[model samples]
Target: MMNDVVLKVEGITKTFPGVKALDDVSFDIRSGEVHALVGENGAGKSTLMKVLAGLHTPDGGEINYQGASTHVAGPLDARRKGILLIHQELSLSPELSVAENIYLGAWPTNRFGVLKKRELRRNATRALEALGCGFGPDARVGTLSVAMQQMVEIARAEAFKANVVIFDEPTASLTDTEKDQLFHTIRGLKARGVGIVYISHKMNEIFDITDRITVLRDGQVQGTVETANTDLNQVTRMMIGRTLDTYFIRAKAEFGAEVLRVEELSRSGLFRNVGFSVREGEVLGLYGLVGAGRSEVVETVFGVRKADSGKIYWKGGEIALPRPRQSIDMGMALVPESRKEQGLVLMMGGRENTSLPHLGLFSSVSLMNRPKELAVFEKYRSVLSIKTTGPDQAVSQLSGGNQQKFVLAKWLCADPKLIILDEPTRGIDVGSKSAIHELIADLAEQGLAVIVISSEMPEVLGVSHRVLAMSEGAIVAEFEGDAMTEENLIDAVSHHRGNVAA
Candidate 1:
């Protein structure tokens, strides 16, 4: 069963809009084994998956599924043949219940056309329980958290009894606990001789759950090796075509004046008595679980969420933050968690988004100095190594890595005294993720006080000079120097209780 090739694609090629998404890529998924497909952004990972799922027709290729050469005409047709793709992006209808979403468009009914609601709920519950989902089938998908919604998506796939399951970044938004459950579920599927195509950028997950690792770069197959035979450094080299000598390294910078200090900050129903401070030339990391209220604390500090009882000190002077503009005017910037929603203007080009904070700098008497705007954006574009044909290229047209650079460049243009980056490198590729880490370090080296809020332990440890672990709401432990280990940080957030002065 382990050697049974259930899905095979040979000479697959797909091209679109000046990019060769998949160029004669050949791969196979074996029954009872997890095959990982990994690559950098725009490396054709998604394109290959889309072709397999019938979302895109390949320019040229042949697909053999279960020893039969066939074409998956559409998503329904793929699912009808026991092939299911649990996408990274949740596809469930928010308005529908878990049961409804699981059995959507395929509800059982009597001759009178009445739905078998009881059967649907029972089947949905069975799937959810198999995945150790906490919520019941009757719960509305919209009311659930992103992690829970992800679980529901997987449950929907499992309910259909998929023989070949493709999981693309399935653990992206999941918690440590939920990730464990998903791994267990994947192993259970393998035991039943199901073929799994696991795609993710997280190297640890690929190494842990996958039996074979396939590397793709710029729409071509680099190589595929047994997961046990390959290492992280080798796989990364194949993906980016070079050794990442300093994937995550930052030189120490001397601490300067206090940039921001929070005393007894409390937000009703969100966080409680959250006290922390950041000094210039320091990258302070805030590490916590999904519901640990890390983002809420930063939001409250940045004036987007009002604090119930708190004292904010900027440069040793007490301040009342009534609006974000006031904070911005006073030399503070917050790069939000969701880049698409809150960080940058998608419709606007790189120049426009970069100039949003520097309107005064690039304007004279209500008229924008277009040349100045382009010059400023070009400077940061070079500094951040953002790849784009021109400044007029829309931010939405940029890749995830390039788009994140625009967000950072936009705030960097403000020349803030302090910058708060929330989940800075969530969805970007490793190459871009490494570049952003270096940029964060460079920003700190340039004497800008920075606070990074991240769920990834490696990221927090890699970029921060010191880490403040948050649990529920308050700071549980502070790790610095030799104390800053992933084990200690995880322990602090997972088990440690009671607040320490931050």
Candidate 2:
């Protein structure tokens, strides 16, 4: 008996100007199987998916759906043929009720052509119930959390009986418990013989959930293997075609006397009673799973958010900072996770973004000092290696790695004693990641206190002198000396829980 092939791409190729995004890629999805598509950033995974979903028509080749030559003219055409794509950023009407949002385009109508609210609610309730969701049908989508909104999107897909579904980084914003719930839903879809296309940068999730894996690199297929046969190392090697530099350069430096300390930091719903200290030339890494409150802890310490109760000491004296500006004034800097959104103004040029954080320092008699500013830009442009057409080129035009360097340059200009990095290497390439790691170590060696919060375990283990593991909203474990291996760090993050805050 021949197995049913739900979807097939025959030598599909797509190209953007100056970038061959996809090169003669051929892939097939069988019914009732989870097919994982894995690759590093800029590996053309998103481009291939977009082509498959009809967001972009391939430059060459054809797609066969359900054993028939078909073209998905648009998203609506794909939806009509039982295809659903769930993006990382959910698409839903927030102000509408869950029931209304689920059946938005095809609401139940009465004999007089008026919307039948009762039937709409009943049908929506059934869809959520089938997916094991706990949300009420009448609940407003805007009021629900991101996890719940994702569930609603799944319910909407199920409501239409999607035969083929694509999940693009579905668990990026979800907690462990929420991820478990999503897994249950995926299993339910599998039981009903639906085909799933999973795309992600994470290895563990792909191995755990997918039946087969396809690795893409440089806009081409690297390899495809059975999930059981391929190990993480083999798959990672295929994804980047590389022997990765997992061992970071630990510039062992003699730490000076204590420079920063937090005593019983408390921020309700984020973290509470969180306390740690960093000496000059010390690198303290905060490691945890998504929603582990690692970023929140550092954000509070950097004064991005007001701590409900806590005492911060700089050089062993109480130093209270109520806002980020206050913290900046007292020699603290933060390179936020979303560099484009939070750290740099993408619409502006690189030199402007670099000078933004410390513009007041370059001002003379309420007028800007162009010469001094240009000199400062030249200094950082050389130091960070920010690739640009020129210093006057918009930051948005640069690559992901170069854009991240611009963010670092902006903060370094502030001349802070303590620097905090949240997901510092996120979405950046390997070469740039290495550069950033080296830069952080060099900064710490120069007698600056450094705090790094990263989701990547190897980075945390390789670079940090001390590691703190957080779960829920508090630190659950601490590792020092030689106890910071990848396995131990994963165990600590996976099994951590803390006392409930009063």
Candidate 3:
């Protein structure tokens, strides 16, 4: 049995400042197997992978490769031993061609150190052919789409003759067709006896591709089981230490007067004819597949992007092309999808970040009201259960969930009437997700209109009062009450043709 194991991890423990990321974690990967690593964010999945990739030196652990205990000094050392990691954020030179990126560091050269361009192209083309990638080796990496870049990464991994490959969130930015192509490529690798370690948040992909599943919770190994012998509910339970029912339950809130109305909103080449309304206490869910134009619709409404043709009515009165500041001034707040880049200033302290939108309340012409700022920060920190060393702690040092909480704190301080959250619980732990869901429900209960844009079917179905499904730049279907099932939502987004109830 040990002979079949390609990589083995035992008693792995890694600690960061004030946090133990991984504790006594143990797992194994076998040849010709697609092993899935499923966990909530901050559940030690990435930490453990970093240890294996030579990016992090575990405080305590034993790593055995090919039945022999080995010490991987660095990424180059790991790669030399037939191990390769394909990061979620791809590592490729945008200015270089596909062939150059594939044979990046170790390019083919003659004894005189002259670059062998022909041999480099031939090897890269062979690797691409192995994965059935259609792109030419001469194409510049930057000109390619995200899905095509992912293929190039796979080709590079094969070019290195990697026996064990790790993929982190490989399909997060891919479309349905691109995902199919990736799955086909993975199957081909498995057939060739390469061990695969797949990390993902999407449950459907795990069951579809993995041979076995391992669940991690709070820096510990919950369990590992065969995919054929388990279901999503069971796996989710192991990952979160509770059933999904408790995590999704929300009390109904009565809706009041309409607060937002968009009529025939159109952003050329992005979204078109997108029309929807949210009442004073309604939580409207916007559901769609990747590239279905859900984010574009919300961004247009938030004034982050200009709508070519539409009418935006706030509190029943139509408004013209308002920029982000004007939209914020009009009692609207947007917690963008990319929180790190768009939601918060990472270098600033929590107190400073939370008070950014309402600085006037804590500052005079030439003097800052320190006590008032601290008081406001403390109020939201307690309310949102944000974990931090102090109000002065840098937002960058906080966990993903705490950062999300900080973003919410910033918006809540403005006392907004309408709040828009795009992928609010993305890249966070299950515990934090439940907490945020409850918080959203609480805000709606207090008569604050909310619009949630999400790609997760369970999140949309569980939290929203009504769901609008988008496909190919248009609202194809709407669901409420008894009609808001996952099957109906999937059909609406995938089929791209359905009745619009709105």
Q: Write the per-residue lDDT of candidate 3 for residues 21-95, one digit (tens) a residue.
A: 999999999999999998877788888888898888989989999889998887778877888888988989999
In model 3, the runs with Cα more than 4 Å from the true position are: 1-3, 250-253, 392-399, 490-502
Each prediction's Cα RMSD?
A: 2.5, 3.9, 2.8
- Model 3's lDDT to the true fold? 0.88
Error of 3 at 4 (Å): 0.7
Models 1 onward score TM values of: 0.92, 0.83, 0.91
Pairs with steric clashes in candidate 3: none
- lDDT per residue for candidate 1 within 1-502, as digits (tens), equals 8999999999999987756789999999998999999988778887888888888999998999989999999888888787888888878899999999988878878899999999998999999988788899999999998878877877766888777889988887777877987898889889989999998878888999999999999889999999999898999999999888887866476899998999989887787888888998999999988878999888888789888898999899998854687888889889999889898889889999999876888999999999888889889999998877688778887777789889999888878989999999887788888888888888888999999988888888988999998887778889899999999987887785444333
- Relative to the true structure, candidate 2 reaches a TM of 0.83
> Which pairs, if any, clash in model 1?
none
The digit string of per-residue lDDT tens for model 2 on 337-420 reads: 888778988899988898887879889888989888888888988998765667788887666778888888888888889999
Candidate 2: segments with Cα more than 4 A from true spot: 1-3, 110-113, 245-253, 267-273, 287-293, 315-318, 337-341, 344-352, 361-406, 413-415, 425-439, 455-459, 469-477, 483-502
Best by TM-score: 1
Ranking by TM-score: 1, 3, 2
Deviation from native of the Cα of residue 404 in model 3, angstroms? 2.6
